[model samples]
Target: MAGRRNGHAGRPRVGVLALQGDFREHAEILERLGAEPVEVRRPEDLRGLDGLIIPGGESTAIGNLMVHSGMLDAIRSFFYQGGAVWGTCAGMVLAASATTGPSQPLLGIMSALVERNGFGRQVHSFEADLEVKGFDRPFRGVFIRAPYFEDVGPGVEVLAEIDGRVVAARAGKVLVTAFHPELTDDTRFHEYFLREVCGSDERS
Candidate 1:
């Protein structure tokens, strides 16, 4: 689906982690789809949101800011309460339970294990048409210093992959992509997150 109207009541209130990364891009996409986008810079900002997005940037920067701002626990509670979370690029690293190389602080909400910059350096960056689950058309995936899932827990379902490597995955209310869908015109992925993951919860 390209977009979904708030059939039941108000639009789903989605929060974008403003700690770092391309958070503004995500906010624009959400607003275009008719969902309320809240920029979350502090723990208080997390209140009264239906879903959240961790955008692509340096994972360490985002993680450190989250901890310093006391947003880590708040986010964990949000995810555990069935609030949907979508992590793009570096966001994937923070969302995963484990990662390749050095260990870093994570939300540890999803069951997936990710490898940071698994797609190689910026010179190796590329784009691919991904046939994501539940979408009829292929989605353009922009991989830039992206990370890929090396292992997934039992409950996790892979959405899209390239060259047999996991690039997108979902588990319960959480969704993650190694590529930056926000950088593209396609709002299908954001639509997918709101309609499917957020569901009918008007407050979300």
Candidate 2:
């Protein structure tokens, strides 16, 4: 926990995988919470990061780059050493052990079996008011061709859902969400990730 009766605490550094999309917004949110968020593009970027965020993008592209740059092993190493990680939207896809389509390469650090595009096609992208645990008001989720979680491993904990489908999950220090939290100003989920995974300072 960060020191403070009500502000961030400690020298917390987080990394956002930059091999994809929507990382900047996540970084900006982290900055607003007084965390140092770095853009991670290569295996070298994994060093010194307390936590990592895999942003929403094309998961296949991100996975391919991670393999080519030797970052897939780097990420798995980070978690092996007890480092924390968060995955959102495309990130969730990258974290899964099994996905709906071809067996794409991944960090495979999470205990999830995910279904890509389970939420329908691009035109089916829609917003829904969600009630997430640990958040006060209903959170509006932005699902842009979002994937949904299915057949999670025993270690995973469901955090949020819609229509009986799992949208968010956490297992130990790993957090994943099928929606784009960065697309909204709602900071609860980010704060939760920071506290649980990143161990960043708290906000007032």
Candidate 3:
């Protein structure tokens, strides 16, 4: 999936948080898929990026950086301005409306409540073949110390799940995945994200 059709001019320039996460892999995937992916660190870094990806890592650390660096407010404002966002793993937790964890700052964009490391520890990482809706084949979902959406509201659309739990969802310009789609060989998830969320201005 590709964002927009106005030639490369309309192609989205995506940013992956490089503060402290698996951002390099995500950047590689986004670049390989044709989107201009950049690394984001501070509030100043948010400028010029069409959309952003909060990668999988220590959520609390990312949250601290958001508050200390003013990225939390910046990101929220970005969302209010119709910007597209994709969150993977810990990023999903930060994007959720609520979380069942200790006190920590959050961007809190999506209308979903998440549980941190709800799937277990990093050593418990596992792979699953997901039957994601709107895709032709099963998606190879990689969950590593992942967070899961425990309470999803009506505004959200459960795009992919496992054993009746949400692992990936979408709402308007916001897209999130509890598992790492950037880790898998299949590019369908990124493709769908680019075509649907990033390229959606025309459809709207």
Candidate 4:
């Protein structure tokens, strides 16, 4: 099992899905957080990693690429084997069990119904200070053609919402966020994934 190294003696190895958008941003954040960020473009790239982040991009494009690259099943297997996974924006859409509007490829690990571009189009993009659970204060959420969960299953925990729309959630080792945390200077979200989710306690 590619589970988290809870008692590891060194920095945790984290993988960023580089098949799509904003991966570099995530990698940079991980580096700043004292983690060794690995760019995951193939199944082999997931080996020895404690966690993985699926970055925001075109859902259809990322999904199709995953299918073509054999990453869909690879990631499913990785998660089932106890790997922690976080999805942002379009990445959140890919993690959903079901999505409103046209169907697309999904990881279907999270028991949530999502709506693509729930907030509206690019012109409708906006920002807000979100009250994230367990956070000291508010998190600056940047929504760029983001997706929101219409409903989540009983096992899923709602982490943040705006106007009753679920924008962040977690189910077991999986985390999903509708907004782009990497766009901000705040490293709280990334730190949360590393320490809270991935079980890494190392600090830079």
CA RMSD of all predictions: 3.5, 4.3, 2.6, 3.7
Q: Write model 4 residue lDDT over 38-156, tens digit each, in one string.
A: 99999999988888999999999999999999999999998877788899998899999998889889999899999999999999999999999899899999999989999998889
Query: Total clashing residue pairs per candidate?
Result: 2, 1, 2, 0
On lDDT, the leading prediction is: 4
User: Which portions of model 1 show Cα errors greater than 4 Å?
Assistant: 1-8, 200-204
User: Residue-wise lDDT of candidate 3 within 152-194, one digit each (tens)?
Assistant: 9877889888777899999878899999887878888787777
- Model 1's lDDT to the true fold? 0.85
Query: How many clashes would you count in candidate 2?
Result: 1
Order the candidate numbers by TM-score, best to worst.
4, 1, 3, 2
Query: Any residue pairs clashing in model 1, and if so which?
Result: 13-204, 50-204
Q: Pairs clashing in candidate 2?
A: 9-201
Model 2 has an lDDT value of 0.82
State the lDDT at 2 in candidate 1.
18
Model 4 misplaced stretches (Cα beyond 4 Å)? 1-3, 200-204
Q: Which has the higher lDDT value, candidate number 3 or candidate number 4?
A: 4
Q: Between which residue pairs do clashes occur in model 3?
A: 1-191, 4-199
Instruction: Report the C-alpha lDDT of model 1 over 1-204, residue by residue, as the tens digit.
Output: 112222335778899998788899999999999989999998888777888999999887788888888888889988776677899998888989998779778999888888898989899999999989888999999999989999898888899998888999888778899999999999999988888777633222
